[model samples]
Target chain A: MAADRVTLSDVAREAGVSLATASRAINGSADRSVRPELVERVTAAAARLRYSPDATAQAMARGRTTTLGLLVHDIADPYFSAIAAAVVASAETAGLQVSLATTQNDPAREVQLVDLMRRQRARAVVIAGGRSAGSSTEDLAGQLAALRAQGVGVAAIGQPVPGVPSVAVDNLGGSASLARALLALGYRTFALLTGPRQRTTAQERCRGFSDALGAGGGVVIARSETPFTWEGGHAGMLRLIDDGSLHGVDAVVATNDVMALGALAAARERGLRVPEDVALTGFGGISTLRDVVPALTTVAVPMGELGERAVRLALTAEGDVVESVGCDVVVRASTPDLRRR
Target chain B: MAADRVTLSDVAREAGVSLATASRAINGSADRSVRPELVERVTAAAARLRYSPDATAQAMARGRTTTLGLLVHDIADPYFSAIAAAVVASAETAGLQVSLATTQNDPAREVQLVDLMRRQRARAVVIAGGRSAGSSTEDLAGQLAALRAQGVGVAAIGQPVPGVPSVAVDNLGGSASLARALLALGYRTFALLTGPRQRTTAQERCRGFSDALGAGGGVVIARSETPFTWEGGHAGMLRLIDDGSLHGVDAVVATNDVMALGALAAARERGLRVPEDVALTGFGGISTLRDVVPALTTVAVPMGELGERAVRLALTAEGDVVESVGCDVVVRASTPDLRRR
Candidate 1:
C-alpha cells in the first residue's frame, strides 16, 4: 500500500501557522515580509515532517523547472561521456539537475529530444554533438527556434546551431597543426580515415589536415570515409591495407581518437609495429585513451572546458555568443621522430 | 520576446469542442468512451496548433513524472558510462526520460541525489554504484524507503540496498574463476590491487580471488588499497613495485579493468614487458579497453545487461526481485600460459 507523503498543510498545522504563512516561509514568497520567528517555526516543522516540495508543482507555479536537458550522440562514447560529465558537474554548481538524452546519432531523435525538453519547460538545453546537414537539420533548427521562443535557453558544443550560442573547438587549426607536426617528422605520404562526409567535424578536420600537408609538400595517397566510430576506423584501416593503399604511405591520420585507436588495433592484428612500420595520428586527445600502448598522437581539445563553457553560454541570456577554445598537438610514441631516425 | 505556448484550451477552441472532451481525447480518459470523430477532431486541431502537452502540468495531474533517475559514481568512467548508456536506452524504450546524477563516490551526495529525485516525483530510480556500510548508508536507506513509500520504484546494480531489488553481478564468483584460471597457468605468486576497503564490490572481489588463490597454493606477496580509478591502480602498482613487494610476484591482479589498464601503463613505464616479465589480470571487461596492446585478461561482466535489468526490475511492480548475472573469464595476451614456458 502506498503511504501518504508529508504535505505542507501538515507542516502548517504542526507549526500552528496559516497556510499562506507556511507557504511563504517554506517556498520563499516574493514579499518576504513574514516574521523571522514564524519562518523559523515553519522551517523546523517542515524539517520535522521531512516534507519535500514537489518539483512538478514548483515548475508549474514558476513557469520553468530547475532542470537542464543535455543531448549527446552516444553516452557510451568516451568523447561524449567526458562532455556529459563536465556538463553535469557544472550544472550542479548552478543548483540545476540534468536530464540526459542520447540521440543514438539519429538526427530525428535529436529533434525529438529538443521538443521534449521544451515540453518539460527545462531551464536550458545543451547539445553536444556534430551537426549533419539535411532536412533533419532543418527540422532540428526549427524545433530549437521554437524552444528558444518559449524562453528556454539553448547552447551547443562542437558545432554551431542556427541562432543558438555555441562553444566551438578549434578543430581546423588543431588538425592543421597536427599535420604540420607530422610533416616535420618526415611523413611524406599519408592515408586519411574520416567520418561520413556530411559531418562538419570530419569535413573540417580532413580539409585542414590535407591542406596543411599539401602546403608542406606532403601527399595524401588514400582517403576513406566511414562512420565516426571505433569499428568504422578498424574497417577503414583494414580496407586500406587490403587495397594496397598503405603500401607507400608513411603515416595514417584518423579524424578522431577512437577511430585512431581502432586503426591501431587493426594495424597490430595485421602484424605492423606502430611508428616503426607506419606512424599514426588522431584528433581529440581523450583522457581515457592516454594509457593505450604506443600512446596516440592527437590534438588535445579541452572537452571538459567545452562542456562547461556550453553550459555557461546556455544559462546566459546573451545572443548568439560563440566562444572558441583552442587545442594543442601532443606528440606521443605513436608518431615518433622519424627525422631523427 | 517570449512567445505564448499553445494550450489545451486553444486546441479545444480550434476544434469547436468542450474542454472536457478535448482533455479526454488528448490525454486519454479512463473510460475511453469518447467518440472516435471527436477524438479525431481534437487530434487534428492539436496537430494544427503544434501543441505539446506540458510535462509539468501532466505530472501535477497524474501525481508522477514520466522520468527515471539514474545515479552513477562517475559518468566519465567507461564502466559507469556503459551501464548508463544501457539504462538510458532501456528507459527510452519504456517512454521515460532519465535524469542522471553523479555522486562523485560520496555517500552524502548519493543521499542528496535520491532526495532530489524524490522531489522530482520520478517514476523509478536505478542506482549503479557500490554500497558502503555506514551512517550515510542508513541515511540513504531512509531516503530510498521514503521514495518507495511514495510509490516510486527502486532498484540497484552491483550491490543491494536494504529491502530493495537488485541486479547483482557475480563479482565473487567471477573473481574466483579468474584466479583459478591464472593458477592453472602456473601463476603461483601474485600481488593484489584493490579499491577502497569500504566498497562492497571491491571487498567481495578481493576476498574471492584471495580465497581461490590460497586454495590453489598460490601466495599474495603484496596488497594495496587505492581509489577505484585508473590513477589509483597506477599508484598502487608503482607503490608495490617500489617497495620491492613485487620483486618475485608472478602476476598482479587488479580488481577492475581500468585499474588493470593503469597498472599496465605503470609496468610499461618501468620498462617491464607484459606477460614475459610479469603477467597481469583484471576484472570487468569494459569494451573501450578492448584495443589495448597485450590485450588484458579480465572477467567479462555484462555491464550493459546489468543496467538494462536494473531498469526492468525498477519498472516492474513486483516486490523485491533479485537477479544475478554471470560473468566469463576472458584470457587475453596479458596473461600468457607460464606452464607452457
Candidate 2:
C-alpha cells in the first residue's frame, strides 16, 4: 500500500518531463524561465494523477520548508498561549505553517527540539519564553549557526541566544517600575515569590525588584522559590503563611501573574482582605486577570505583540540582532495606595 | 549560494555508494538489505558533508511525514490551549511533531488549512471544536476521504464530520445535568449567555438546558447571543441587567467559563453578592477558573484528555467512529443550593 503512494517523480514521469523541469514548472521558481505550455502540461498531469505537492518533497527539491518551529516553555500557561496564538497568526499571514513544541523549561529538551527543527528544515525556529541558564550557550549558538548556514531564520521571544535576533520584554525595567509603584503605595516590607532558580528571567526580575526596594530602604521579609505556575504560588503562599513569614509583610510580589493569582487564592482562603490586610502584585498582565476582584496590579508586557514581533523579526531580518520592548506597571485595585493609610 | 546545499546524490558520490543505497541507509528503511560497512561509509560521508537528511525527501521515499496537523478554533482561548497542550504532549509521546493552525471559527479558513495539511502530507489531521454548519458536510467528507486514501489519519475533537473518527464531549447531557442541579437548588428563574447562535455546541447546550428547564416548569427570562469571549459575556450580562430582565432572575448560566467569569465581574460591578443576590455558573471546567472567588460551579470537561484521546483514536483506528466522554456538574460556592431558601 505504501509503495502505491504518489511521488513528485511519478508526476514528472507521467507528465513526460525532467524532474527539474517538472519542479520548476510546478513551484514556479523566479530564476527558472519555463514555457507556459510546459507549465500547463505539468498542471494538467498533476490534476489527472491527483498529485499534491508534498511539502517534504518540495523541501528536498528546494532547500526550504513552509513550516516554522515554535518552542514554548508551556502552552497551558495563558501567557505563552497568548504569544503562541500571535505567532501562529503571524506565520499564517506570511504563508507559513507552525510546528509547535513544548520544552516544559527543560534545557535538554529545548536543545533536542531545536535539533529536530533543524532536521525538519523549518524556515525558522521561534523560541518563546526565557531560555534556561542551565543550557550551555556555546552549544546552542553552534547549533543555531548551522541552521543559519542552511539559510534558516532564527528568532526568539523573551529568550536571548547569541547571534540570534529576539523580541525581548524589558523584565528588569518592568519589575523595577513595579517595585517603585509598590513602594510609593507604602509597601515597605515584602515577600517575593520567584520561579525556578535557574530561569534567568526570574533572576533578573528578582534582582530589579530587590534593587528598587533597597533604594527605598524597604526590606524583603521573605523569599520563596516556586515553579512558574499558579499552584507553585499557591503552595508557596500557604507555606509562607504557615511559617508566619508574612507576619509583618505589607505586600507580596510574585515574579509572574499566575503565581500571584495562586497567592491571592491563598490569602482569600485565609480571610485576608486584599489591599487592606495585604497588597499583592504580579508581573505579566494576563487578560484573564482583568476579572479578578481588585484586578491584578501587574507589569503589562504585550504578550501577543511579543509573538508577532518575534515572527516579524524572523521574516524581515535586517542587521539588528535584538529588539527590546518596554512594559508598563498597570496599577489596579489589587494594590491599594498606602498613602491613604 | 543555492547550489552549495549538499544533496543526497553528493553524499552518495563522496561515499562511493549508489544514491538508492545512501537513501535507504539514511532513512533506515526495512526493505533494503544494505551492507553494514556501506551504511557506515554513507553515514560518515554525510556527516563530513554536513548533510542533514532532508525530512521532505525522506517523506517522498517513505510515503508519509512524521508531523501531525492540529486545527483549533482559537489557541488563545484557555479551553483550546488546554486541549492543544495535551495534543502536543501526546504527539511527542507517539514520536510525532505537531503543526498547529487556528481557524478563528472561520469555516472557509478551515477548509483552506485542511487543504494545506493535505499538501504538506500531515500524518494525521485533528480538527478541534465544532464544525461550521455552513460548510457542506459532503464536501468535508470528500476531503476526508482523499486524506484517508492518501493514508493520513483523521480525527476531530468535539466536531462531528461524517466518516471521520471523533472524540466528542457530552455537552447536551452535561448541560441538562447542570440545569437539574440549578433547579434543585431552588432557582426558579434563569438567564443564559450563549455563544454565537450558529455554533452547534452552543445550540445543543442551550437546547439541553432549555429542555430541562421546560420539563421542570422553570422560566428563563432572557437569552443573549454573544461571541464566545469574556467581553461578550460581560456585555451580555450588563445588557440583561439594564433591560431589567435579570431583576428577578436567580442565576445566570454562561455557555463557557471565560464568559461566566465576565458575568461574575458584571454582577460584582453592580454590587451583587454571588449566591446571595444572584447565582452564577459556567461550563467548560478550565483550570484557571479555579482561582476565581466562589469557585465556579461548572461542568468539568477533561479538555486535555479530549485532545489526547482524539490523537489516540486516530493512531489506533479499530473502525470505531466516535468516542463519547461524560462531563460532571461540579457544585461550588458560586451557586448556592436553593433548597435551603
Off by over 4 Å in 2: A1-16, A28-33, A44-51, A318-320, B1-7, B28-37, B44-51, B134-138, B318-320
Candidate 1: chain B TM-score equals 0.93
Candidate 1 chain A: worst 10 consecutive residues by lDDT?
A24-33
Docking class of 1: medium
**Distance (Å) between predicted and true CA of B228, model 1?**
1.4
RMSD after Cα superposition, model 2: 2.5
How high is the TM-score of chain B in model 2? 0.91
Candidate 2 C-alpha lDDT tens digits along B1-341: 24687888999999999999999888866455689999999999999998878776677667678988999989989999999999999999999999999988777777788888888878898889876565555576678767777778888898577788889999899999999888888888998998889888899889999999989878888888888888989899888887888888899999999889988888888877887888899999998677787788999999988989999987776453888989999999998877776
Whose DockQ is greatest here? Answer: 1
True-vs-predicted CA distance for residue A297, candidate 1, Å: 0.5
lDDT per prediction? 0.88, 0.86
What TM-score would each prediction reach against the true structure? 0.94, 0.94
B227-251: candidate 1 lDDT, tens digit per residue: 8888999999889878888889999
